[model samples]
Target: MADSDGEFHADDASDDLEDHRVTTSSKHDTRSRSRPEKAKKGTRKSGKAAWEDIQRSWDAVVEDADGSLTAAIEGRAEAEKRARLLRDTTPLQRGIIRHLVLVVDMSFAMLEKDMLPSRYELTIAYASQFVREYFEQNPISQLAVVGMRDGVAIRISDMSGNPAEHLEKLQGWVKQEPQGNPSLQNALEMCRGALFHTPSHGTREVVIIYGALMSSDPGDIHETITSLVHDRIRVSIVGLAAQVAICDELCTKTNGGDTSSYTIAIDEDHFRSLLLEVTTPPVTRTQEQSNASLLMMGFPSRTLAAGDSIHYCSCHNRPTKEGYKCTRCKSRVCRLPAECPGCGLTLILSTHLARSYHHLFPLRNWVDVPWAEAKRSKACYSCLTAFPEVPRTESGKGKTPEKGKGKNNSGSVPTPLKGLSESGRYACEVCRNHFCIDCDLFAHEVLHNCPGCQSDTRGAQRQNGKATSNGDANGAMEIDS
Candidate 1:
């Protein structure tokens, strides 16, 4: 009996030992699973801390930088970048000419002093600049001017390539005080008539610099907009004061419901920029426009003044010593870019022909290089002036100075150089050479040749061969090849 009791006690002890083993294994499994979770939590915390540090560093850098010119430069850079992207996607068709009419509002509203020195004066100033830039950018495009006042729209200047004539007419007209309401409808009708005579190969556009909030229309403007759309005429409006519903509707209908065709100018600079953008080639709307057509042009040589023979000019119908004679009909005229009074052929100056070539070969936008990335040259490539050091902030970091801050003790901003911001130093994309702003403008405008490009042997040879022929003392005419 004692041996059997001992055996039962041994069995119970073995069962209790097995149960302890199972409980210990379960606890070990739980601890192993929790180890991975803790490690993941620690990694996430470290990543968040690193990101916060980077953000703080970026904030400090921006805070220590100049804010005034930075915004303007950044804005312009972003706009240029965006424009390049759009240009890459959209291909421009060759031999596409434009006929543009500028309609200026000469109503009483233009006399308002909201735009500083009066809206009329400011408009004229920007308009003059726009005319010069337009001819520079779009050499083949023809321009005309119209004025609306006293409920009537009058043609100020005939369509011509010479911007000087347009400026003269505009200046003479502005001398009189602005009066009466603006008749936009009349202006549109007159412009349509002017553009209707142009060839179908060219795109017709009208730009209206309107100041008044209301337009005095003699007829239904909606019908006029539909007619313009049907005729493939694109109309753009630049409002000086406020946006009008009629202008918006006209732009929308003419541009195929694209609302971006209209814009309101915020300031003088913005206004000038927007006006210049209109000089870009417009995208052809029809497939039929792909076929090229010959346009009749006559290059008239300048005839020197031999003596006072009382020769009458066909354009002004007055006696003049020096006048241009049409190559086609040999008819005498007062100025160029005029239709020959005898043969009705298009007459243009030699400079007009030379300027048109720029559209085919446009100057590339200069690249803005960082001071560190720029070559260690002491002087500018074009101007040969010493490079100015980058302005530093209290934090020992480089900062661009504001525009007007570089004035002398006389409270006058410095001439010529003005003030150079960090973005002002531009490097030629082809030659990788740096130049100042004044040099860049002179190279593109006056010289019409990149200084770096002109230095190349091949470029010099080409320039010599195609050197811009001087305009005749009177004017030279162009004949379609």
Candidate 2:
């Protein structure tokens, strides 16, 4: 092409060199010789600049397994894509950024039936709306997600500015069942790998939506969270109906951040407000300071994951003198009643109760509760009892049931079940022995620790006969005759 704007030339390649010299002459010009000498020097500078441009472009096209591109590529591609996309859309000015947030939580604790459709469903619905609205306002802002399912880390969707694509990916990811168990540490690590490592420009964040459910080792996430905060990466947290105590600790230790917890809401407006508040774009420095102060002032009194009983009593309506605690449950109950509100047992009249409901519930009353009622309670399906309750005192105080009168405390002797008197053929999953339903589940959960998800190979041995051609030992097979 000819020199359209007189910035270049069709045949005057030397003129391009002249342009470079003019732009740089004041900074690097030295004693000049003849025209020919100057032209040769200009050519060398031109070749060096051209080489740099090629190297920069090449670095952009390659990326790693987790979808992070090199800085050279990541920076250029992001800029180029933004420019191209903006050509058809509105540009973001100051205070113009819209937040595209994706909150994910599939922790097992979320499966509790007390909440209709479950906590996991509520989280997904609100978070999905947040993603939708951000795209509606500023389509170019990036969205990302990570969560846990069955203890395995799940990357819901890679960070991307395309809302339609990101939403589609998240929907697909959510359809699959939770993997093993919930692990918040695994989810946060996945978020770190997805967000900060890449050459993402502008600001980035990873909001954690969770409750008292968490992993065994949250301290392990300290380095990643610290780095993100120091970098000025926002980590807004939504505490849901409940949240992990460590979440507040992590947020405070790094950024002195605030969290929001939504009590079960009966109205749509409340749900909308909770969603909007958590997903709002980052506030100014002064507002953030105010938020930090608010977080300090309104500290949550109930401990996160302090076991169900303490959590329940701490939030109960009747407030007692702060120190009047129950002796038997050690659950900080008022002195008005001799019975512990947690376990519904008579108080022992000691400074500290000898038993904690968690231990007593699992060890003594777990199987003792009728299966019908236990099914309605939020007990572990495998163990059929609520997990142990923890005490609030820092001194490691917890009580256990009395020795002689633990579960089924009545002094009267009881008879064993009448059904077990008759001999019945029931193969045990492990030992392959014939047993009733009562013993089968006990052996499966307690003795075998097997989840009963797979086949029981020992069924053949339980038959006590050779297999028939049709695989039915009851007929056409050699019985012991």
Candidate 3:
């Protein structure tokens, strides 16, 4: 009600008090209205988004007290195995000369015992293994490690191609316990600062084995990520916990929208798998680097002249008897595949380049051998590991058949004489020889050269063009060698 002077007074109300307040019926109606909303909210917060993936293996399963797999978890293992079989093997130009910074989170969250021993201990163990695997896969690549704790980034080791130095650094931290919170921004900033001056020809990468759900960042993480992208640094993260939005966005954007760059480990074994996955050289991005850029590298040779005086090593200011003399600076280096301390020239062995070349033109995948022909084989052509005999089927064949007389495409011994293992066998298309599972994996993964193809004499005969027959007995008996 308005007064005569238009002043509103609390005492001059004509409305009933009951109309201004909620009655018992209104309270009941309000509860009734929010019931459906509450139910929907509960259903929406089902926590599916936090689910971590199980290891993609058939043997990765929970076992009962009797050592038998429970029926409930069998289907999950099969699903993971199916997922592993769907990987893409298409060839791409990957960066072999990589300089990577491995950042291991040393936050309090790492003390959790969900992982064996503890997350921190297991992570360090895996980190050591990752160092070895990284060098093994990327032989010419250099690696450094960074530890993040108490909102500070500390360098564990400097960028070096020697795995022993990195291992020694990791081994020294056995007594050091994890403490404080992880700072993603500080860690990224540190990695960026260290890798900023790397040569544009090689890949610059950051691999973080983060174990925390939340990061105690001092500043905007987005700014650090922008700097990384501008500097062409590829960021890869393997999380011990569920996915974090900031990490997802960081990896996705830095890797140019690839979701495979980030992963969350379900268990310790799965965590190892995820970390080892980073050992493989990442495919190079054209926009991030120039393809036509030229780089000069030195292949250091270990040579010493008689009565030559020993000189101090450039790598370490220590006296050395003999070392690889740098071609550019003429200073002695203690090791190969290192940047010369005096000249900054990339010093490496010719073998390292050959080791790195396999990734560029890898051997083709071999096909699985047929059961009928595989069972007749006696051993591997290379290793000669005896293969288990195939069981006789009830269709009436009971005895082991004689070895086949036919030779392989290499024009040597009959392939069936080579024993095939029980784990099944693979046949090389070019060599037409059977190899057991282990040998097959080695041929394709490590030893890119095929033994059968290398041992064949037809290639030598074709190169020499069948020597003309000599009338003399001594000349006729002369060997090609």
Candidate 4:
């Protein structure tokens, strides 16, 4: 019995040991699962912190990009404003009254779509603007339109001071499809015939808008050029494509070796600008004999169209109530500066006489001021833009150090104005007004009148036939009193 009792105790001991081992294994399993979950939570926290940092950095980058874009936009706006002001304020000169013929190319080459919306379309639009501007600027000047198509030149509109008539004819004729190669010689010959009847007192100018590189001629172009030169007729050609040899020769011969008379259009904008230049009066050739002739002009009065008792126009030789009656001949006419059909007297307007007087008194050219002199102003005299700052060298701050053995280093060295090379200025000799390079160019070319001079009463002195003693024949002005 004692032996059996001892065995039972041992069995119970074994069962207790097994239960202890099971409890230990269960605890180990739970600890292992909890450790893995804790590690995953730590990894998620690190990833979230990293994402927050990336988000902050992205926001900073966006802010910097916005600021840079805004600054660039503002800079461009200021530049455009400066350009606009320069264009609008430029003055115009009242040049001599001229008789001009505008020859446009309606050839197949003009239909090329190189200039956006075809060259023909662009030419037509520009030509219309040119006619309007020409008539508006030169109210007294007579303009005729000639179109070249299918190697034949024809008169689209007769010489007329009325812009409406010319514009109407141009728009109607220019819409047609381009035909064959342009005949430049035929166009010039047609212009010569129309200008032949014009009085010698007024200058005769032929402005050809040539598109084709080659010119189809019926006769020798050299002979035509010779005739034009002898007649004192100046021919200026504005080429649309590359330069042509014949057109260049024509301009040189007629203009007495002046190369500026012929210009090849660089772009659409340049083409329009060149055409507008033709409206200005041509400079008289100094080498040619000045056959100044006195022209007989009669100021005609406009007769009322109401209750016309069978009044007929001397020009059209047709019955018309709305017409001008010549003061000398007492004959009705359609327009001014026309030779009366009833009588051989020249009928003209008072404005025509005023326009011709500009040749007697021409405007003076402005001289360029050096950077050394221009740097005196902190801002541009005309535009008021801040003057460019001078660059600093490693040795000297803003001053250009003096060289040579006798240079004194003891005293305070003077600092030269910055941006001497970049900042260029112009001073009008007559008015003594300072201007930037852009303003200077605009004043000379487009405005033709100095803004400073215009502000003073001296501008009217030219019109009053009173010569300023301060100026020389070469347009140099004397020192200001």
Q: Give the poorly placed runs of model 4, Cα more than 4 Å off.
A: 1-95, 286-291, 301-323, 334-339, 355-481
Give the number of the best model, judged by lDDT: 3
Rank list by TM-score? 3, 1, 4, 2
Which parts of model 2 have CA positions greater than 4 angstroms off? 1-101, 173-175, 197-201, 257-272, 284-481
**Candidate 3: clashing pairs of residues:** 378-418, 378-419, 379-418, 379-419
lDDT of 2 at 366: 14
Tens digit per residue, CA lDDT, model 2, 334-434: 33222345654333221112111111122111113321222232434334444222112223433322322223322211221222211112232333223
Task: List ranges where model 3 is wrong by over 4 Å.
Answer: 1-88, 288-290, 304-310, 390-423, 461-481
For model 4 the local lDDT of residue 376 reads 61
**Candidate with better lDDT, 1 vs 4:** 1
The sequence of per-residue lDDT tens digits that candidate 3 reaches over residues 257-294 is 99998999998779988898887778877754647666
Best by TM-score: 3
Ten-residue segment with the worst summed lDDT in candidate 3?
409-418
Clashes of 1: 4
Count of clashing residue pairs in every prediction: 4, 15, 4, 3
Per-residue lDDT of candidate 4, residues 1-481 (tens digit) = 1265564566767888999999999999999978865534424556554344554423422211234444234334444434333332223332365789999899989988888798999998999999977865566678999999888898999987778788889879755998898887789889999999876566799999888988788888888899998887899989989988888889999988999999998889788888987776666654322545465556777777777477777676787768787676677887765667777776766655554543345445555554346446666666776544322333645444342111222222222122212234556777777776567556655565677776565533453576543333335432211
What's the residue-level lDDT of 374 in candidate 3? Answer: 70
Sort the candidates on lDDT, descending order.
3, 1, 4, 2
lDDT for each residue of candidate 1 in 1-481, tens digit (9 for 90 to 100): 1265564566777888888999899999999887865544424556554344554423322211334345444434544443332233223564446799999888999998878888898888878888987877666578999989999998999988678888899888757788899987899889889998887888889999999999888988777887898787889999898899999999888877889889998987777777777877666766656776777787777786686565788877888878788887788987766777798887877677677665555676665655455444556888887655543332454553353343333232221211233434677777788886667656655565678766644422234456432332323453342
Report clash pairs, candidate 1: 298-478, 299-477, 299-478, 300-477
